[model samples]
Target chain A: MLGDEAEAEDVLQETFLSAFKSIDSFEGRASLSTWLHRIATNAALMRLRKRQPLSFSVDEVTEPGNGNLIPKVFYDWCCLPESELMTQEVRDEMRAAVENLPDTLRVVFLMRDVEGFSTQETADILDLSLSAVKSRLMRARMALRERLSAYFGGAASADMEGTRYE
Target chain B: MSEKHAHRDCSHLLAGLSAYIDGEAEAALCAEIEQHLAACENCRVVVDTLRRTVLLYREEQPAPLPEGGEAAPVQSVRTG
Candidate 1:
């Protein structure tokens, strides 16, 4: 999410204003909400670009070329019950993990996964090619999974306790 | 399964797992991924957790709307 409240407000206002002006262009291809979201996402991306113009590189995370498919860390949580996976602490960790993603990956992941947009919708919204969206999304999910695994894998509770005592 | 065959490298499969999980992959690719998953524990765990991550996130409420600004009604946007 764009961190600055003032800037986010500006983008929100601009989104609706622009949406109003271009209401005629609403072809009914996407739902009204998706269209609005696309506009808002573009507005936010523009603000992000202005603040850090040089940081918007699609190729920052290298594609996994032909190699072993082994994960950096693997903990089998398939045996864990769904109730355990859905704990508030885990949810908080997941939110934090998503927030920590790089902007490019974060936006794509949020649009596709969090907002329930199709991959194509996300690509269109962010003006990214489909492959780029796919790659960024994969990387984002992988990063979050690795981070969350630390929590579910039992390393996080000790860290949490240390923070509490300190 | 033989060690060589059992530890089948799945880089290609891993690359497509996101699309596969999202139901975006072509049927053939989905079949391939399923076949690989049937034999590979590592890929299975990665895919499973990645899926749960998405589900957990979807369950979260959308970020609070900008403070003090309710969503403009659809009627207003249509008229203005």
Candidate 2:
């Protein structure tokens, strides 16, 4: 999501304006909601592209060197109670982790996961291949998983009890 | 198995994991991933945590757009 409220407002306005202008071209191939989402996504991408260039090289943190996606450090948090995992602090961490992702990965993850767009729809919206969207999504998830692990696996663990591993 | 084959297998399964968790993977691939996950504790942990992370985000309420923000009426576009 656009971090600035003002910028988000601008994008929303621009999206409506653009969609309005191009309504004649609305071929009914995609649903109205899908079309509007595509416009919104493109508007966001335009703003993001202006702020930073797309990252073509994958980050080294989750790069599959030996064909293994193994985390440098892994902790099992599967047994943590939902009450603990759903804490406000954890929610904030999730938001921050997502916001920290590179623009390319973040956009795809948002369109695919957050917006509930199908993989094919996301790919078409972002003008990326299906495989590319999948790869970026994987990288984004991996980075977030590692970050959340570091958070919960460290000091946070002290505050919560009954964190068991299988 | 040779090191190369073992690494390839791991890579293959790892690459397909996101799709598997999303219920997008083919049945054959899902079966293979499930089989691998049954035996590989590390992968099981990764998949488990990754799934939870996505779920957490999904459960969040979407931030509301600015107040009184109305879409441009489609009728205007059609009429124009």
Best by lDDT: 1
Query: Where is model 2 more than 4 Å wrong at Cα?
Result: A54-69, A160-166, B1-12, B67-80
Candidate that would win on DockQ: 1
Which pairs of residues clash in candidate 1, taking residues 3 or more apart in a chain or in different chains?
A: none
- How would you encode candidate 2's per-residue C-alpha lDDT over A63-164 as one tens digit per residue? 645222445435678678988888888888888998898777888888777889988898887777888898888878878887888888885566554455
What TM-score does structure 1 among the candidates reach?
A: 0.77
DockQ of each: 0.44, 0.40
Candidate 1 per-residue C-alpha lDDT over A20-86 given as tens digits, one digit per residue, 9 for 90 to 100: 7899999999889889999999899988888888769766546446232345656666567777777
Candidate 1 residue lDDT tens string, B23-70:
889999999999988887767778888787777778777767764666
* Candidate 2 colliding pairs: none
TM-score of chain B of 2: 0.66
